[model samples]
Target chain A: MSASVALSVEGLAFSYGGKKALDDVNFKIRSGECTLLLGPNGAGKSTLFSLITRLYDTRDGRIELCGFDVKQQTRKALANLGIVFQQTTLDMDLTVLQNLRYHAALHGMGGKFANQRIQEELERLRLYERRNEKVRQLNGGHKRRVEIARALLHKPSLLLLDEPTVGLDMPSRQAIVEYVHQLASSKQLAVLWASHLIDEVYPDDHVIVLHKGQVKANGTVDEVLKATHTGQIKDAFYSLTQGEHA
Target chain B: MNIIHFWRALWGIVGRELWRFVTQRERFISALVRPLVWLFVFAAGFRAALGLAIMPPYETYILYEVYITPGLCGMIQLFNGMQSSLSMVYDREMGSMRILLVCPLPRWFLLLSKLLAGTGVSVLQVYVFLGIAWFYDIQAPWQGYLWLLPALVLSGLMLGALGLLLSSFIKQLENFAGVMNFVIFPMFFMSTALYPLWKLKESSALLHNLAQYNPFSQAVELLRFALYAQFNQSAFIYVFVAFIAFMAVAVIGYNPSKGMMIKKAGV
Candidate 1:
């Protein structure tokens, strides 16, 4: 509810036919911080990302980006948002630069402005030399970097990455995690990073642990550990998600 | 967004589509080859069997190739429309369509941009087919080519919108082949793309009525009339209305509604 809050979701609900995917989910992501949406598979993490990104309708409750309601003021709300989906979205046939330029155009950037922004993003990601290469030629790690750069090309205040490191080596995953952490502070961006990997959670970062379509825990990593009476994030996540089943 | 920006975005999408079209050389060749085979192979076999009266657009006997040329143009648009839809299914599966949909622009505008881009490619293919046909002695007035431009675009939009509407209903790439078998082939075989309504009526009144109601037939008739420097008011109205209806349905299907199967994202 603070002025600096970049994204806010309250009582969000969604269902697929007879099955509920999300129920009464609530959280807020503030600027200059990275919040991990830590959940196992089928925990409604992707569904929540879908709702926040306006990929699905906010049927029951509200999601706002930079104070703009995603449903009503959709254009304005989406203008402040950037997203890197779980699947690789870059056009493999196009060069790395072409992929970024295409994304910029989708956000209404053109000509000199689009070019300069693409150049800046490429350099920032250290993929400038590979800009002319087809995206398929780039390795898994570089492809993710290009995607992150594409998402940032529009200068969105809020970034939503849905299980972005799902298919990568440990080193690549660690590098991406560290890179986005740097981006959060350096760019003053509010990032909602969804992942099932327990290792991705850092003690200082905010975490929202979802289980079976419900918000099981929402607090900093240390607070989550404290509330669950656990010594580590992995154990904390386990107790919160699997305690009833166990 | 400003008009310039809108145009730029449209250009970007269209440019990517064009780039893909060029890279996929077989797509361009197949797009042309389907209609050419109909024009040369199929039409040639039927040339001796089917005779033509002096229609209003023709002052003399016309070759079967010339008669079906416009229909073949319509065929190109039809196939291209479905081709684009197939790609839409693939894009959805591959997650690129999600990127296009999440843009801050109006959904209608984005879909229209996609329609226009696909139509642009279809138009290019149509002209290439026409250019090759001209060499085969299928002649029209020089002005006919000029008139064909707008006609191709209008008909292309109608077919493309239909493709978009179909894509919205198709849940996966595998389901799209069913669309081709049920939707594409039926629409093509039942339409005036291959024969005139009178010919269909001579065969069966019910078949004639069905062909008359088929929007693909209306689109072909519009192209036929336009290519000969004539206007068919009914055909134009049919296609225009079909465009609106198809586009509306497509937009509705793509909307994140509560009960729609399309509401499921990222899968």
Candidate 2:
């Protein structure tokens, strides 16, 4: 409910028929914080993201974005959300600028303002030079950058990324990790980055480890480490999701 | 939402579809070729075998090609509708649909915008087909050409909504070919696209009734009358009502909470 709280999920649960995909999940992401959602395969990471983004409606509990209930105030809540889905959503034939402009327009931005925002995001992602290139022509890393740029076009309050670095090379992955962390602080953005990659976690980042549709641990890096009694995040994550395969 | 936002989003969606249509030369060619082939080849072959009576829209006996011109226009819209459905399925599978759905606007508005965009593209294709038919010596009254625009828009929206409904039911791209075979062919052939209701009665009473009641038949009749500078009131009402019904169901089908997205989320 606080102004800084960009995303809050309370007693959230979702199921596929009888099988629960998410169970009583609770978390709040404040502005200027990067929350790493650590979950193994089938650990409800995508389901949580889907619910938060309103891709799948919440039936069992509540979700709010920027103090607006996603269900009751969907338009306002969603207006504050920018998502980079796990898969590449860009049109392969469209140029990077075209794709970003489309996103801007969808968010109800137009003319000089929309163009200016597109340029700013593209430039910040170091993709301004290749703005005219077709998305298909870009390397995997560059395409991901464009997706990132597109997500940021509307200046959303909370950015949801669902395993965005899965297929990228190490350097690209590293660059994105750094860029997102810096972006969170610089822009006062709230970011919920879902990943199974423990190495992507930063020392200052908040950590929420999920397993089997439940939150196993949620705290700051130090708090989670202290609670789990582990020396490192890799060990902490393995211990939290002990039975699941990485 | 503000009107400006709604307008921009509509423009963005329509512009994207137009860009895609313009860039894809093969799609444009195929859209025209299908109707043209029916006009040039099928109508040519059937002209001697079938004769037309003095229908309301036709004051005198008309050639097979002339009789079938409006039907071919309906065919273009129908095929274009299904093509839009195919692309919707493709976009969903490729993950692009999520981007469109996540826009802050109402879901119904988003779906309607998409419907309108597809209808716009189909209208463009219909005009192109009509232009080519004009060259083939099939011409409508100048005012009728203008009148056909609204009819095409209505018919296109109805067919496109039907396509959108089918896309929601279609779970995978691999299943779409079967749906096209099951849906497009029957709707086209069972209707008056190739023959009149009276002609169908000569073949079978059941076919006559079915063709008489088919929504596609009404759409064709609407186009046929409009192309001749006359209005078919019953056909207009039928097509308009069908468009509303189809659009309602398509909107519901795409609803995230109650519809296909739930099934999709099961993954």
Candidate 3:
């Protein structure tokens, strides 16, 4: 419950029918930091994202974004939260400007202020040149940039991306990862970057390793490596998720 | 939420609906074409076989095309309602709906705004069909056009609510065609859209009773009466009540706790 914590979850639990999807999980992402939620496929990453975004109600635990409880203060909490879902959400037929404007409108930004912010964010993403182009015409990297730009239009304090780089080529993937890291540092925005790829993690970055609906490990990369008795994160991740053979 | 924000969100959703409607030319042509065919082709064929009686709103006999124009208007609204819901299903599966539901507004506000937007589009389609019918020499009183406004709005809201309710239950887009065959076809066929209630009674007592109870029939009746600058109190009551009931269930269907938003967590 520290003031610096931008996103907080305590004892969150979820299930579908007889199967448990998330179990008593707790974690926090502080302002001005990027936390890598690394887990393999089918490891409950998407489910956690769904709950955090309030797309699915939190059945058993509390989730607070910027100190506002998600369920109790849904409006305030969601206003402070921005998300880039794994799937491409841009209207394929709408121009980049139209897509961003629609998103801005959804967040209650309009008129001169919305236009100014749209220009600034698109410029920041180096996507201003293609502002009038339809989203489908943009390359994968540019489309991802547009999504990032749209996510930042309202200036949310916390940003969530669920496997954002899933289908991108290596260059686009690396660029997006780097851009998000820079976004966190420059804007003091807290970020939760979920992915199954180990290479996306850095030694100094915070990491939360989830597997089998449980948070197997959560700390700095070095700490997780130390806890799992491994020399590198790749080894630590495999050992923690697949059992200890290292 | 601030009042300005609420208005902005509503405008945004409605604008998006308009944008999509304009971009999909095929949808526009088809929406108009379906009812136009019923008015010109089907009514022409049935005009010989059916005889008109002195109904309450009409003192003299009317052509079959003239009689069914209002009903055809109702059909356009009904189809537009279902088409909007179809897009909603596509949005949900494609992840854009997730973006929409995450807005800071109340869920009911968001849903109601969406329904209103769809209703607005459907209303526009109804007017277009009426204009086309006017060109074909089937006309109502000019004042009836004004009276028809509220009737069209009410019918659109009622049918859109039905579509919203169906969208909540339809999990996948592939199953939507089945919903059309089951819900749309039955509702359209079983109603008095094709024939008067008296005519239906002559055909089958059960059909007369069923048509009397059908909400779609009531909506068409309301529209038919309003086209002559008159009102059917019973039809109005029936449509109002059905609108309330369908809307309540549709709102509940979009509730995050009960709606399609929730997915079974990956085991």
Name the candidate that leads on DockQ.
2
Fraction of true contacts retained by every candidate, in order, equals: 0.67, 0.75, 0.77
TM of each candidate vs. truth:
0.97, 0.98, 0.97
lDDT, residue A34, candidate 1: 93
> DockQ (Cα-based) per candidate?
0.60, 0.74, 0.68
The superposed Cα distance between candidate 2 and the true structure at residue A177, in angstroms, equals 0.8
Off by over 4 Å in 2: none
Instruction: Determine the C-alpha RMSD for candidate 3 after optimal superposition of all C-alphas.
Output: 1.8
| Chain A TM-score from candidate 1 | 0.96
lDDT scores of the candidates, listed in order: 0.88, 0.91, 0.88
Which candidate number has the best lDDT? 2
Among the numbered candidates, top TM-score falls to 2
Regions of model 3 farther than 4 Å from truth: A243-246, B263-267
lDDT of 1 by residue, A1-246 (tens): 677999999999888766888999888989998999887788888788777777788889999899989999988988898999999999988999888888888888977898999899889878999999999899999999999999999999999998899889989999999999999999999999988687887667999989989999999988988999988888888898885321
Error of 1 at A210 (Å): 0.2
lDDT of 1 by residue, B1-267 (tens): 688778888989999888889898988888888888888899999999988888856788888888899999998999899988889989988999989988898888899999999999999998899899989998788887888899899999999999998888887899887988999899999998777888999989999999999999999999888888888889999999999999999888788753233354533
For model 2, residues B1-267, the per-residue Cα lDDT tens digits are 799999999999999899988998998898888888889999999999987898878888889999989989998899889989999999999889999988899998988889999999999988998898899899888999999999999999999999998998889999999877899998999999888899889889998998888999999999999998899999999999998998888887888788888886553
Q: Sorted on DockQ, highest at the top, how do the candidates line up?
A: 2, 3, 1
Candidate 1 global TM-score: 0.97
TM-scores, chain B, all models:
0.95, 0.97, 0.96
